[model samples]
Target: MTPVQPRTRLLFPLRRRATALAAVLLTACGDSSTGTGQPKSTLDQAVQAMGGAEALQAVTNEVVEASGSRQSPEQGSSISTPRHLSNFRYIRTDELDGDKLHIEHDHVTTYLSPERYQFTEVVNGASGFVDGKDTVFTPAQTSGMFTSRATAELGHTRLTSPLRVLRKALANPAIVQEEQDLEVDQHRFKVLVFREEGEPELRLLIDPETFLPAAARVLEDQPPLGDTVVEAWFSDYRDVSGVKYPYHLRITLDGVEAHAEDRERIMVNVSVPAQSYEVPASFQPPAQPVVPALADFGKRSTQLLQGLKYLTQTFFYFDQSGLPITLNELAPGVVHVVGPSHHSLLVEMKDYLVLVDTPLFYPERSEATLAAIKAKYPGKPIRYVIASHFHSDHIGGIRHFVADGGVTVLAGEPSVPFYQRAFSNPHTLVPDRLARNPVPVTVEGVKTLKVLDDGVHSVEAHRIQSIHSNDMVIVYLPKEKVLFVADLFNPNLFPSNQPAPYVWGVASGGLYDEIQRLGLDVERIAGGHGSGTGTMEVLRITGAR
Candidate 1:
């Protein structure tokens, strides 16, 4: 699976100063005078804050049990809810020079032990493999990736386990310190913030009376969300045979929260079996489809024009080979782009050709489409490329075609600044798209544009005031009575019976109203990412009164 980039938004001004203030505090703490002269010192304070060194060192086995609820909202205020349960185990090992640790967390065994090691995850049946180095044990399920490398500074001693959070703080005294109190659930806790430059602040809330941690909060390093925090609550401390355990751990990200239970039976000391850290012999990776190089780019091109086409008349589909390999081609010179994810269209113009959307980002697909266009239209040049929106998928390939001298057009409002910033500096993500061809971009207005140089191909770059995106545009061929649009309606079946109004609801239905309102006389519509080509009745199916 592709790694999702971290959603990091930093509020600049105050955050910059706060970062500097945190640095000064950490630097001051490094002074020998900063240490509390109580026989134990800061290192001992951390160990006592947890259970103790001997108690922590005695921990041989640990188990965690947890449960949580999840939900995803769909169109029309609909939602899907899923609940899950998990169990976790950790054991010390002499495998990697005795410092190695092995972790097996079941819900189906997601996270692994040892700081910088490879691990696999199976969460709610979704499986993924990760290979990276780390200082602390990593969780299998995460809300998002950390934008900075601050996690590398995290010591095992900072974690809530026997000798866990203390071990690192003892070795690095500047890592943890006490802070002001914060009240929650009518109880006050002494908040102590951990410092690691350039990283979000990690705050541990300790119960004032017991000095036991009540919760852990990591504030976003950036300002606006500087106070925006993710927290994990630890509770139900139980000590067995000198080893301490927190029976319950609840994590909250943004507003969502999940809880897990710790080991039912804690083992203080036992000989762990060998081969525990080894990858399971029965482990198997999920089967992934072989993607054709250029085909992925072709899929991306189709996704840009979704809100335009609705229930289909003659929709087109492509096979896996990415061959323009027709899944089902219904007519000549008109193609509906249909894939598993988005929508699109293919228009064979008089001389060169016009493509409606470019949704996916595949190096080979862009090349393949250009190659196919060349082969299909022997001497014609692909003079124009239309983008329906500014979404990454829709406009990802604009620079590719623009490099080829193809005049790229977008919805005037947002597209101007978008393309300007996007292509201001030469695009480097994928070079081949614009390698041999470099073209200028044209921003189309909220009106009609007709190109009669080669054929009667009209461009109706209208505004789609829809929830999908603001800068949405569509291409139209009045002479052919075919309109190319994206994200409007996805025709799963040719001549889809689903009403356009019901398909896109108020937003796209308003767009359908604009079609008739503008008097384009469209008869056939090709969608942005899915199968296109729709009859006049299909358009009327969602028309406004």
Candidate 2:
């Protein structure tokens, strides 16, 4: 798998520019002691911003009932189908006990405990007892419990709520205004802006009438998957206790939509004993760990002598924007490599080229990579596209490329038919450009086939066994002694000097077995994501020697 885009670090800028600007502005507007037209101080504003102490204290528990779907741009299996949807309900109960507060959730929940000083989790199905003092769970299910809790907290928020919407803006520190005028819900109100670490800043669009957030926008340095903006809309505000909460929330991540809900009822002042957050007796975590094989390759079908350039690929993710973008690159000439989700390679054989993987549907990087490839190698035209697998990031840009008259697409045999059926369906997740001009594909079969027989630098192709995907192919260059493969390996960890097998290739030993079976001479190897080039010693370290 390709490495996720690194989160941009905004600490220095925040401390240097944002904080200084806020301080300077505060100082300039000071001495308005009467509090007449002046905005409240930061502390006072923080208190008032949260609806005052009375409102905050009014609610003790919140149970919400909602049903929605979770769609992953990484998930290509559910494209044009309802299978992408996962219906669920969420419940959260925050019990304040004196200075210590214990929060619990009916579903899997992630939170920072009162006593532990660290975050913990409570999984659903299995019962957990929490003492109003410190929340605890059985050691057996610790991983699952904590994962559930954290996922709930983060996933539960609707991008639409006033608080959440504002929180999104405040995530950035660039904007200094306490409030600025913005329009939302057919009304004009003062919205706040702040700069966060990376690409874009956070914006809070509040309702002028109630000071509630009607919507929020996050800005990133790059655009979203489709080279568009991202926005979260918070709606269905209902007062739970004294706190106003938006029941329905919709988030357009680069353009993909995700939703969540709170079910049951909101509880206020319903005190609980300090011993409820304790470990349950029935909890038992299994002693054995489930380690997935990463390097399992089945067989060799074909090789692309030219497709080995992009073997070492790295991706960076830019989010919280209207159109979040992820960036990565492919080695030149190494065309048509496939992997699982977000793990694919598309190399344009000619001087000017196009890459298939835009980083898990983060199109900004994809576009950048294309432009960079073209700019770096002047006079080359990227007129061909290929997918390594059926996952979203691998093939999401097919329409974009195809619309540009890119010809001669190559993909897994299984993928060709799947795409043929998908191209004709309603394109709700993304637009369908493959339907415009049927993409010509050279699906790999049982035997190996060479794409180009250039005597000086020939490209070889092969079909390999991959546990991650059934119809996967690998490209090789006999002359260059380089291999362009996907999902089977990542060369990035080479610089870190990490141990062999690297979790990915070792997990799927089939690739190693096939390499040995075919007995192809290879000195260097590249991957679809992560590291691009590395010596064969990396795989040999995992017992292949």
Best by TM-score: 1
Q: Looking at model 1, report the run of 10 residues with the lowest lDDT sum.
A: 305-314
Over the stretch 1-545, how does candidate 2's per-residue lDDT look in tens digits?
11121122331122112222222123233431235766553423432445654565454433344444443333333332211323333344433321122334222211111112122333222222222212222222232222222222232232233443333333433433555354433355445665433213445555544455656665311111222234566666666655666666665433445444433354455555544344444342343221111000000000000001011111111111133223233334554232332344444453434344333443343444455455645676655444555554445455445444534455566555544433333332233343344444222332345365434445556666665565566666676576766556666643434444333545335676777777889887766655446556666554244
Q: What is the TM-score of each candidate against the true structure?
A: 0.47, 0.43
Candidate 2 residues lying further than 4 Å off, grouped into runs, are 1-61, 64-317, 320-358, 421-450, 454-457, 494-505, 543-545
Q: Model 1: runs farther than 4 Å from truth?
A: 1-26, 30-343, 348-352, 425-432, 435-456, 492-503, 542-545
Each prediction's whole-model lDDT (CA): 0.43, 0.41
